[model samples]
Target: MNHEFSIESRQFNLWYGDFQALFDIDIGIRQGIITALIGPSGCGKTTLLRSVNRINERLGYVRTEGLMKVMQKNILDSDVELAQLRKQVGMVFQRPNPLPLSIRDNILFAHKLHTQSHEKLSRQDENNLVENVLRQVLLWDSVKERLHQKAIDLSLEEQQKLCIARLLPVKPSILLMDEPCSALDPKGTEAVEELLWELRGQYTILIVTHNMAQARRVSDESIFMLMGKLMEHAPTDQMFVTPACKETADYIEGRYG
Candidate 1:
């Protein structure tokens, strides 16, 4: 476990009931940079992403082999706490899914849940947190006056921004995003990409995206998967300009998904 990597998988395999979705996944996701997972639909990109936070295990029949580690600790151990794992590994889904609560409350929800009652923050501290996170996601000015409004009422872009904002108060070290921009329009996608750039070097970002252009533009490294197997992993530019494998080249060139 090199300190330079935030997440590592060794011989990782996963199955949903009798259907295997991932095979021999060995990866070392570098710290403090964005890594994009790209492949066609049903290639196990999302499955790999969800495994980072153990989200795939929600299905009772799902089973896994090998280790998935974060910060050098294997999270597959029976004693590992789901609550704590999720706190350190925040996830953003394909669509914005803000809680049906006030905007302020939504920002405060995770902080409040993770903090012990005796360690609760003062009202002023909570206010500062909400403001800081919103500003981090570039949403402060637009919704500053609407803190009490229901989060669901925000525009789709704002709602997605808020979803990302709400994760900050907990100080997550890794963010696992599954097609985070898929539901957004072009303008919204651009805004979110800007936010991703702003967030770079502060957290380890692993994003699953079908958009090759977006992956090339936003990620420092790119990972290509095919039929539940890792095909290539390299610097984004190198992978795009000179893929080492024919499968990788074919997928990038749009010859095949």
Candidate 2:
């Protein structure tokens, strides 16, 4: 029951009907640090992130085994509410998917859903909340004057930042990012990477990325996975310099994924 790590997966296994996606994944993701999950396609990087938020269960045939805990709660428990879990663990997808609403509304959307219904969050309170989160994601200055604009109208980088901003008002402890910068150009990628640094130590971030350089730049710790199995987990510097496993070394050297 201890919240030992921001997220803990002990002997976790996952399957899609007859096909297995993950095999006995055991990892202790330290609190408030960025951990990168790097692997080739179909290596279950995204599957692991989705599992923390129970997004995999949306599929009828999906089944899981072993313990997967987020903030000390076993999310696989039948009694756990998806909404409550999601409130504690937010996810940013590979693409920015803002609702078809104004920038302000996009930021306010989750706060409204999770807050007590009877409590009237004053207009000022809502405005403050929006501004605070926007600032957290480093988007306040650029979009501050365009709060009423539709989120879709913004540049891809801005929309991605807004997606991250929206998650903050919910007070999430864990942030799961699945290749969050894949859609951005070089400049946009750099901007978001800086924002990720800004967010470090404030929230536990688990990012799945194909870009090895990006992972090395943003993550304090690195986890290498291959063919649905964990190859190695180590400090970012050690992982890059002296990988413990041959598979890891191969992957690091740009060999077969």
Candidate 3:
């Protein structure tokens, strides 16, 4: 219930039909900090991230129990407005997926949705929004001259940056990135990492990654999961150096996944 907490989950459980994916998970994420979720494949890292934003609610057999909140509002409540909640918390996926439209339109699409019902943005306002967010993601310089070009025509890394740019125009308070750098090359990964660091002051970020080095580089706090359970959560440096749990220490030391 603390206003400083951006995300909090209490006794959260998730199931897909007869299979239970997450079991009574409790976690809290502070505002304006990067929280990294690290775990081996099939350990439910991505599931937890998706649930935070209610993306998993789309699955027919998927059911969740307990409380999950963002900015002190209950996300699991049926009466909540999902559209508005999603605007407060945005997500970036493992692969880059840009719309078939032009670069300018991709960023404009969401802005139009959120702003249209209130008041339409002037042409100059729209242009400034697109340019500003692109610059924030460090893609403006390269794509400034080609704002009208098709989004699909850009390189993979550029497309990914554009996706991040698209989210920024809406001004979400929390950003969920699920293996965002997995598809990028070394240079591209570095660029995304730098962008994440730069965004720390403005947005609360939670990243799910298998790469320990990436977690250490961009995260202030770390949460480790295994077999659909939280093993440990601590400051990033301490989690890597002096993990409190034997399982966490063994996993980080490469003894076993």
Candidate 4:
């Protein structure tokens, strides 16, 4: 267990029924930095990301071996509570999936869920919380006047920003994003990338992105995976400019996935 690492995997292996998706994955994701997971389709980037919060177990058929740790605790332990674990780890899906509720309510949803039943915030405090998180995501000015409107009404970009905003009230130490800009246009992608830069150093962000340009633009560190194996992990510039592995070089040079 390394203090500098927010997430660490020790010989981690995962399987969907009989088919293994991850093979002896051993990596340490440093704390409070943005790391990008890159690979072609079916290379298990998402699987590895989902494993941090144990979302893979939702399928029931998913089984895992080896250790996956977040904040130095092994979440696979039976005593670990998913609800509390989720508080420390937040996820942004490939597509925006904001709750079908008001923007204000959406931001408050997770906070309320994690709050003790007896612990309650006054309406004013709630408003402050909403404003604070929305501002953090750089969305408050745009959505401030429409807090009561349904979140679904926002454009894809706003919806995605709101989705990211909602996760903040819980104060998650790690954010797992699976190609969060995949559903957005170029402008939207740029906006989200800027927001990610704003969020750097505040949280440990692990993003899975197929877009090579986006990976290079935003990540401090880059990880290259192939066939469910970690091929290379290096500084973003180093990996792009001078990849260590032959396979990594090949992949970056427009070779076969």
Candidate 5:
């Protein structure tokens, strides 16, 4: 399927004070598809992901240069609202990290924050929102009877799905996942992988992963990064079957990390 949204970065650079983390990098992420960033640790995969959502700009002494645009809006622009950008592009971390509240409250948190922007959602609207997103993630059946229970009470996999559910109420245009399945067990990983496929039609997804198999399974396009530079990027099947770069081939063939 073709993407409806587009993301592009040109000569993007990132630095943590005197230390540079990302080299000047250029890439484009097609909307409505899963693009996976794969590489060894500290190679700037996460940094690139953070830059897409402008998360890196929040750090003190961190500086960015060049241009980053999402859906034609320049995210690097000074006038851009980081909060609003974050709402349009939601993120999911490696760990569950659900709030210390009831399941219902967790899903409603984003809605409550922007209450004035949206008409006051009646209880039924809230419930429908929760039910729809939960079902999309295949978690509603498991948690429906326990909506009032503490979020911490759910299983680790269920908690991760709940976090995903929380993002849906705000209707984000893109989903950024940073090693979302790294903390999961085999079963939990499969759950998240299945959820990703289910969500591809509704939102553009960009994921950073160290798991090559996971990338092969879930991503339409795969990007390989090494030492702060892009090594190779291609359709998932082609990349794994015939990597264009030696480093990418080595990594995928289990020759080296």
Candidate 6:
């Protein structure tokens, strides 16, 4: 079952002051699949991921030319509301950055911010919302008993999962994860990889990772970028077995970054 493109970038160029970070990037990321963006450090993989949700704009010096569309709406247009756009596109950082609040409140925080009627949400409504998203991220069974515990007190893996769960209440169509496992141990990485599989077909996930092995394990499609330029984007198996570009092959072979 093929879904429509969740994100499309056409002739997209981004610059941080005089230094350009992305060059004419063009791709259509399909809905409901995990797509991995891989490259060496400073290769602009994160830059492109940040671009999808317009997070790069937070840096006042940054500028862009061309188009970036999320959910078929051209987000580059000035009329697009940042809050609504962010609600549709969620982002997770390299390190788990759960709020200092309790796990339950962390999950409800975004929903409360986006929702106009917090007082209207009954006691049962909030509890149901918390349980639903926690289960979605597979954190329910483990943290169910301590829903009100400080989110930071949880293990790194639990914190990461909570970060993901917190986004669900907003009903984002696309999730931009930048090295989500970079801060985790091997076991934690594996657990999150499993979570990614569980999330497939429900949310379009674009993840950036330096670990090619992780990319191969979790991604349906792989995109390799080099020095701010996209070298190749193809099915994960094909890209690993027989990359169409020498740049891609060399990078995968550890010959170059």
TM-score, per-candidate, Cα-based: 0.99, 0.98, 0.98, 0.99, 0.95, 0.97
Worst window of 10 by summed lDDT in candidate 2: 1-10
Q: Which sections of candidate 2 miss by over 4 Å? A: none
Candidate 1 residue lDDT tens string, 1-257: 68899999999999989999999999999999999999988999999999999998887888999999999989999999999999999999999999999999999999999999999899999999999999999999999999999999999999999999999999999999998899999999999999999999999999999999999999999999999999999999999999999999989999987
* Per-candidate RMSD, Å: 0.6, 1.0, 1.0, 0.7, 2.0, 1.7
Candidate 1 lDDT at 210 equals 93
Better of 3 and 4 by lDDT: 4
lDDT of 4 by residue, 123-169 (tens): 99999999999999999999999999999999999999999999999
Q: What is the lDDT of residue 156 in candidate 1?
A: 91
State each candidate's clash count.
Answer: 0, 0, 0, 0, 0, 0
Q: Which ten residues in a row have the lowest lDDT in candidate 6?
A: 1-10
Q: How displaced is residue 24 in candidate 6, in Å?
A: 0.4
Which clashing pairs does model 2 show?
A: none
Cα deviation in Å at residue 250, candidate 6?
0.9
TM-score, prediction 4: 0.99
For model 3, give the 10-residue run with minimal summed lDDT: 109-118
User: Sort by lDDT, best first: what order?
Assistant: 1, 4, 2, 6, 3, 5
Clashes of 5: 0
Show model 6 residue runs off by greater than 4 Å.
1-3
Candidate 5 clashes between residue pairs 3 or more apart in a chain or in different chains:
none
Candidate 4, run of 10 with poorest lDDT: 248-257
Which lDDT value does model 4 have at 83? 96
Model 4 RMSD in Å is 0.7
The positional error of residue 45 in candidate 6, measured at the CA in angstroms, is 0.7
